[model samples]
Target: MTVLQWTATLVGLSFALYIGIAIWSRARSTSEFYVAGKGVHPLANGMATAADWMSAASFISMAGIISFLGYDGSVYLMGWTGGYVLLALLLAPYLRKFGAFTVPDFVGERYYSQTARVVAVICAIFVSFTYVAGQMRGVGIVFSRFLEIDIALGVVIGMGIVFFYAVLGGMKGITYTQVAQYCVLIFAYTVPAIFLSMLITGIPIPQIGLGAAEQETGTFLLDRLNGLHEELGFAAYTDGTKSMLDVLAITAALMVGTAGLPHVIIRFYTVPRVRDARISVGWALVFIALLYTAAPAVAVFARTNLLNTVTDAPYAEMPDWFTKWEATGLISFEDHNGDGLIQYVGADAVDGTGQPVRNELTIDRDIMVLANPEIARLPNWVVGLVAAGGLAAALSTAAGLLLVLSAAISHDLLKRNWRPDISEKGELIAARVSAGVAVIVAGYLGINPPGFVAEVVAFAFGLAAASFFPVIILGIFSKRLNREGAIAGMLSGITLTAAYIVYFKFVNPAANVAENWWFGISPEGIGALGMTVNFAVAGIVSRFTPVPAGKEGRDPAEVRELVERIRVPRGSGEAHEVSG
Candidate 1:
């Protein structure tokens, strides 16, 4: 079968499976919608969590970033992975024990203030929308290429599919669906890596193939790639370009941001017990390791394959895959010197005859992973499978983020704050309605995103780190943390971070470089500074303010007791219900 045929067949089957699962596990109550009735098995929950946590940024864009950025991209690898461990060890179980439906719920109850809940709800919505924009863009990219539709139309179609399962089944549906998505995405990701590894290095394992010598030249792959890069006036593949301070700040922001994500934290609430949450986190780490370890290998393989095939090639002799991607407007060529040959070079590059030539080709980084198999002349079925995998990675995270948005609006804003007398059934209807609206908004963002998939996602993580991380951590560990302090911290942190990102990314794009960055921190790393400001502001405010009550009209000692209980895990079947 051709690539299109294979893609349609595989994508159709996957969509059917997802729709069926949603129908089978549709939520009937608010509990089911919000937390799947808190009955998910640890193993299944682990798979679902992995699927939720590894967004399109991981499956589709991380390798692409690494392929182009080289050693500077390691920050993403370290930050995202390390952040998961931080979440698992420090936050997941405790949050599960708290028994809140959303992060806002936890904040409102823990801090005993409706205003705090409202602030948290706003933060969750802001962060979620920013993150979901990337997922929707991922969907559009896959459909635009494989289905040969316009990106805007593809986003609309993806929005429709997500709306069906997310609105009808809620967390109950999304959880089981994510388990199947995990299977599809992981298989799709690894099979192509294995094929390309053997094709390039005569080794079946991609991880080993990364360092193994090439079959034809008997030179190590990394060494060959370095030579190619330097020959083309690009930095050596193994060399780092980012400063140490920027790297550290970006890594720290991503790490803390991961621990504070509302979507990932909500997954722990779906499991049966705190013990199950901990165990599920363990299983999730193992599942996550599979793709994380192979990413650098895949990056190396794709980069090597791309450079070998395209550099200095004639435009008339380009492959079918190149033309197909070119039609999507992702890859373009211009005859700057009227030579009719592609000069895919870096800054200030000189030709073979020592003549300075401009780069004549522009390729989008997000296409590298999706186009890797095709570029390597792999089977049609492999390309199709990757298309499906990218969709799975994207859709799974979109559903999770949409749910967070819905819960924040319906549960946090309306039911808890505005209309306390609202019925459970009414709340369920509200959740679905809000989620539907969110899907449409998300589609709009996808069609008109501010940046590429990974870059937009990095901004979302920065927002989460600056706004949510400090508040969540202090809420859990500090008994003196009052609602005023939490609200102030969230507001100040998110404001500073968002302002910095906007100023550099939008207001002054020319000065986005390192020289103009405040204290050598780029917009991506400014979240760390914002987080520090949050901690300082919250600590100072709490020190000056009077000690607040744990609950309305309750004694102050109970606040200390509340923090103590969150720190310790009770036995199975113990009192797990936290009073709201």
Candidate 2:
């Protein structure tokens, strides 16, 4: 079959499977809708968590970013993986033991204030929306290319798929569907890596192939890539352009933000026991490692392949893949010198004839991974598989984030705060309705995204770091932290981070360069600063404020006891189920 036919078959089959699963595992109560009835097996939950955690950013954009940015992209690899470690070690078990349906639930109960819950709810919704926008856009990109449709229409179709499962079955359906998605995405991701590795390096294992010598050139793969980069006036593949301080700040923000993401944190709440939560974390790390370890190799393979095929090539003689992508407007070339040869070079670059000329190519970074197989002349079926994988990765995360948004609005805002007497059935309906609305909003954002998939996702992580990480950490570890401090910290941290990002990204795009950044920290890394501000403000305010002595909050002694209990692990008892 042709590539288009293969893509439609694979994508249609996957969507059908997802819809079937949703019908089979439809949530009957709020418990099932919110946390899969708190009965998921560790291994299944691990796969589901991996699928949810590895969004479109991880599957489609991470390798793409690394391909273009070279060594500067290591921040994403380090920060995101390290952040999962932080979540598993420092946050997961405690939050799971707290028996809450959502992050805001923990904050509301721990801080003993509806006000804190409301703030957390708002933060969760905002961060989730920001993150989901990237996923939806990724879906649009894949559909626009493989399905041969407009990106806006692709996003609408994707929204319909997510709405069916996410609204119908909630966490229960999303969890199982994510498990299937994990299998599809991992298979799709690895198969191409193996093929590229063998084609380029004569090694089937991508991890080892990345360091091996090229089949034709005999030089090391990275060294060859570096030579190509320098020959084209680009930075060396191994040498990064970002300063050490900025790298440190970006890494820290992503790490903290990963631990604080509402969608990821909520995964732990689906298990049957606290030990199962920890076990699921371990299992998730193992599953996540499969793709993470292959991403760098994929980046190297895709980058080397792209530069060789495109640079100084004839536009009329370009491959079929080039024209397909060009039609989508993600790749374009202009004849600056009227020579008809593609001048795909960096600034101040000289052509093959040794004449200095302007760069005449514009390629979107997000296209690297999607176009990799075609660039390497891989099989049509493999290309189709990747299209399916990209959709799976994007839709799985979109479903998870939408669930977080819906739960924040329905459970935290309505059931807990505004309508304490709301019935469980009413809350469930509201949750489904909210998810439907969120799908429409997410589709619109996808049609008009703020930036590329990875950049938008990084901004969302910054928001989560600024708003949620400190408060959640303090709520778990500090007994004296009251509603005032928690509320103050969240509001101040997120506000500062949001305003800085908006000013740089939207308000003053011309001044977004490093010279204009405060303390040389870019908007992406500013979340670390915001997190520090949160910690500082919470600490200072908690010190001068009156301690809770059973007056307007939980008893001071009880709060301390609660902290100690969460710190110490209990036996493998049944999971504590929170009432609706």
Candidate 3:
């Protein structure tokens, strides 16, 4: 079979497996629909969580960013991976102990107000929708490139698969399917890196190979990459161009935002106990680290290979991969002097013919990971594996996001607010309907992407950090934070963050908005600012308003009880069910 045919068959088989699993494990109640019946083993939950957390951006875009940006790209690596530490230490245990099916459920019960629940639902939908848009777009890109299908048709096929599993099985189906996806994606991601690493550095372990001496240059792999980058007028591989303060702020935003994402947070609810939740995060990080650590290796190898291939090579002899990617508009080169020889030099260098050689070769960063194996002239099977991995990453996250979107509508908004008398069967139908609607919206966004995938995803994270993280954290830890404060804080935080992003992303003309960002901080990294505003607004508003009455108020006794329960170890053999 041709590469496209093979890819189609692999992807189709994977989808069929997921659909079969979903039919077999369809949710039987509201509890199962929302939290997978809370019976998932800690290790299994960890794998599922890893798949859910590492979306299309992580799988397809991150290594590519690192390849071009060098050390500056460490922010995404450090920010995304480091957040798990925060999740394991501060967030997961307490949330699992809270014993709620959804994030909105926690907000409503903790704040003792339906308004707070509604606000949480809205925030969840907003974050999930923005995230799902990128995932669907990623699916389309993979399908179009590997399966040779039209982009819109690819998106529709992906949407149909996600809708089938998510609507049929809810969180239960998604969790198991995510485990399988985690395996597919990780295998797809690491195999090429290992092959490339061994070929270039004579080391089998890509992570260590990245830091080892290069076989050709006899210098550290990173040092060689840095030298190459300097020659090309790019930033040094080990240093950054952004200010330290901006780096600090952006990293902080990503870390907190990762911890705050509603869909990620809800994964803890699937586990059986608070301690299991904590342990699960540790395992999730371990699984994620396998890919995370290998990514830099892939980046360095791909960058070195790319530079070596095109530099001084005859233009007519450029590799097939180069021409193919150029056709996709992801890779481009211009022969300014018409010498038929490609010249890649520092940004300020004069051309080989004595004319100024401006950095005019434009290559999209996303192509780095997807096109790496092909660029390195690896076997076609390796390229096929990467295709599978990219699809797995996109589909797994899309399924999880769609599940949350449907739950927000059917469970939080419809059943809780609009139709309190709805039965379990009716609620299930509502969830399916909501899933169908969400799939349509996500597919549309995928076909007509509004912005770059990474940038759009970062906006979603910022929104989630600003609106949901503060409310959930404060509700659990601070007894004095009231429902009025929670609702007001979320609305204010989301509004401010959205306005800033819109202005910076769409309105401002001078900034390139794309490159010249605010104080060197990109829109993707501005969640820290929004989060600070959220905390300040919530605190000030709460102090001025009277404490809520009854269970909503500052109940020292109940607070102590909840804390104690959360702190209890799983080995204590105490029942893990949520006891009101």
For residue 558, what is the lDDT in candidate 1?
64
Alpha-carbon runs more than 4 Å astray in model 3: 333-335, 343-346, 352-355, 512-520, 550-580
Where does the lowest 10-residue lDDT sum fall in candidate 1? 550-559
Candidate 2 stretches with Cα past 4 Å from truth are: 351-355, 550-557, 575-580
TM-score of each: 0.98, 0.98, 0.93
Determine which window of 10 residues in candidate 2 has minimal summed lDDT. 549-558
Put down candidate 3 lDDT per residue, 117-165, tens digits, no spaces.
Answer: 8999989998898888889888887777777667788899899888888
What is the C-alpha lDDT profile of model 1 across 433-464, one tens digit per residue?
Answer: 99999999999999999888989998999999
lDDT string for model 2 (1-580, tens) is 9889999999999999999999999999998999999999999999999999999999999999999999999899999999999999999998888878999988887887778889999999889999999999999999999999999999999999999999999999999999999999999999999999999999999999999999998999999999998888888989999988899999999999999999999999999889999999999999999999999999999999998998889999999999999989899898988988887777757757888878889999898889999999999999999999999999999999999999999999999878889989999999999999999999999999999999999999999999999999998888888888999999999999999999999999999999999888989898999999999998888888878655433455765676777767688665544334
Give lDDT per model, in order: 0.92, 0.92, 0.82
